[model samples]
Target: MADEEEPKTAFVDESAVPSAQASGEENGSLGNSWSEVSDMRQGLHQRHVQMISIAGTIGTGLFLGSGTSLARAGPVGALLGYTIIGAIVCNVVLAVGEMGALLPLSGGIVRYTETFVDPALSFAIGWNQVYSGCKSTFCDKSGKAATLIQWWITINNAVWIVVFGSVMTVSTLLFVRVYGEMEFFFATLKICLIIIVNVTALVVVCGGGPNGVATGFTYWRNPGPFVQYLGIEGALGRFLGFWTTFSNAAYAYAGSDSIVVAAAETRNPRQTIPHAAKRVFARVAIFYIITIFFVGLLVPSDNEQLLSASGTAASPFVIGANIARIPVLPSVINAIVITSAWSSGNAGMLNNSRYLFGMAKHGHAPKIFLRLNRFGVPYCAVLLITLFMSLAFMSLSKGAATVFTWLQSLVSIGALITWTTISVTYLRFYYGCKAQGIDRNELPWKSPFQPYAIWASLFFLVLIMLTSGYKVFLHDHWATESFISSYINIPIFLVLYLSYKFINRTNIIPLSEIPIRPLLEHAQRFPEPPEEPKQGWKKLNIFWN
Candidate 1:
């Protein structure tokens, strides 16, 4: 008050001030100077980046959870459920690609939110993702009680979380050079495994292998093509059941946004992000849909293996393997499912670290997180995220399977919120671009249908949220406590938003002063060619270059 605190300004002059230098001026006396921090090394090639994105989205959910979804909705219901969800997911990818191709920063959704939406929105999404990722390990659901087999399964999952987390953490700490190579190898291995399973299934379907047979489409008719549980109560029961099944299916597709998190690490994000986004949608839809399609045709949804009273590995995939009389395939698929969970957790850790970093940069987190290690890794932030994740693993002590289901519910809410925000942000981005007189054609990647796509996506997201919580209001047989817990994410987000507003004493900015133009321009930094080669033979001959 002595000097009458210099009037706070919303807009800074980029031309007059350097970003690195301005860090100190903007936030006085911050410990580390941004200028001294070396730029991150570009290590991930386009191919590796794309595949990692692909692997991140396609996880154990499809391999394992699809069976549960198929059982709940039958073949036609499952197909329709995923189709609708897939459309929404694709729209999200498009919207995300539009923003990411421009920004291509490591901060991902958090960064985008900060730029286009309110700072509070950014904080909410970042914190929610961080919380979600840290708690993911406790969600595995393959264990029993007392029996040696059950004890082994529980111990196995626990060991997996620690070992996988440590390995991924150490690998991430290495120079980007090593990290990129390892991720590429891991992603390729996983992809190869998927192809093997798919091809094996195809061969079996076409009467190629030992247990071969053209098993026509008899299974569908055998099961009567649908499994109706809603009774003939009316449209209400049917509607509630549809929502319940859709929510379950959406959980299977929850990690689709993991690709967006890798934007910062990729070499040429503008060129690579769109390709990766497209591949994510295509792979998820085709892989999951076709696999389930075959499963429906091969094994009835009501088959004992597909609808085991116990929800362990007794899913349709496992059942299909057993039905085909394939030796060792069931075990192989189980192992791959575990690895898929590990990969998903690994990606989650990476994502949370960046989200933490973004929050710190935006003044919502401690300044310590903004400091980078010599390798340009945000070591403090990574360590913090890991610690949180480790603590989250404590939920496993309660019960891994139960914990996983709860976590999945939270994941559904988080994903829905994030997707909806992406759409809203895109709408703002579009109008800002137009108002700024920016040429959409000149942008490296433009989302098709503009405002319409954004609006449509937003509409679907709202529908999902409402439908997701519908069971709580209508189903007397369902546990009220469980229903409330499942829908808690909605209230949690509201509380977070309101608390942030109270703390900051802030009001929504007027539409005219929203600062969307600058944000849109900032996001457009993608598509620019890198100043140097990232890897391969070109990297090895740097001296000659």
Candidate 2:
């Protein structure tokens, strides 16, 4: 699956000036395609793009759910799981960024898939994302399983739901610059929290706390590194525990694709996106990997608090802090995480509307979704997507709550399906260039390592998807809900793809007809201005630069 045998491919160089530029054709193929001339406002700045990638994925999942991984896999096992997934996620984002640099289309990978692969594929993934994005935002972080939920007053879920729903709706419907800035501020706070947690954990590990007990590698050696998951013994149990964390780590890294999610709304996307892609991995390494390492060092996996469903009280940082006799950290982490939840929801809403807009543009969704407001936002799409926020109020009725659970079940596998489809689409694009004798360098940004990164990423992603519900098959673990949620999307995606393909009579686009040249020429004809070089103190802002 990695490579194909060399066929009689054309060797003619496509380096000459494209016909559109040579003829000064203003209304040629460049302006007609969906990838070109988006009506979406280009208001997201370079800093916004950079921070979107950084903060979009760092949510309560990292702050709270990370404890679950440590409990299951112990310290060393959990660290390995996050590290492995982090590397794969880096590749996934790079694949999206490479294409986005050239096309900079709205709907991120959805638009890219339609152009490089089959429109049917895009239709399938695009709707999948819309459904998942809308539902996940409400389902996420709303669980009662938290100790630090400092709600000012217990109010009706309906009222709070309406309030949050209104916020998401209004923010996305406004000028995109406003949305970008909101994300920028949220990302900055998340960054600071991670830094604080990591530093605090490191200090505690080094005996900086009142306990004055420097217990370096103490937890690792006492209970050992690997855990005997599900009461199974020895290496297999340890390996299973370690592997389960992949799913948890994946949840933590779920939204790394934000760099290209609103590509059309980004200013100077060609430069901004590639730079964001290159830096995102480093940011993840520093933030997630290093933080996880400290988590392992500071907290023992055997701690019962690690398994508790409580909020920041169960956060590994808080648990570690308490072990070192620090008390105020929980409130601090809790306060920021509430905002993070809202921020994550905001991102989901923005992404949901954009995906619908992209689908409508590609003729896969209702035409109304294409309607834009004075602010250049897909207002119609925003309204339609927010309808799902009503699901939040369903918890009021027991029967309705049951239905909501099943609804949530349907979207569990969406992220895995999304990543797999992205890899497949990118592979097609990578080879299409080869089959057409086009140089990759001709494009605005070419990701380092041809096919290998994506190929490896695809392999691991498929493995994770296959094993996602493995626990459901274990002794006494035959859960109907879990099984359905894990595997149902497989047939659903196939149905969406094959149904669209048969009805529309679509075929896998041949490499030669994939339209790389037209889009490349279009990009060249309207090249983005080169980014100005950094000067003086601005150079210190490495993360957002």
Q: What TM-score against the true fold does each predicted structure earn?
A: 0.83, 0.90
Error of 2 at 279 (Å): 1.1
lDDT value for candidate 1?
0.62
Clash-forming residue pairs, model 1: 102-523, 103-523, 139-404
Supply the TM-score for candidate 2.
0.90
lDDT of the candidates, in the order given? 0.62, 0.76
**451-489 in candidate 1: lDDT tens per residue?**
786788799899888667655455465766557656777
Q: Distance from true position, residue 413, model 1, in Å?
A: 1.1
Candidate maximizing TM-score: 2
| Total backbone collisions, model 1 | 3
Summarize candidate 2's per-residue lDDT along 317-417 as a digit string, tens digits.
Answer: 77887888887876677777777777888888888888888787667888788887877788888888777776666545555434433544454468888
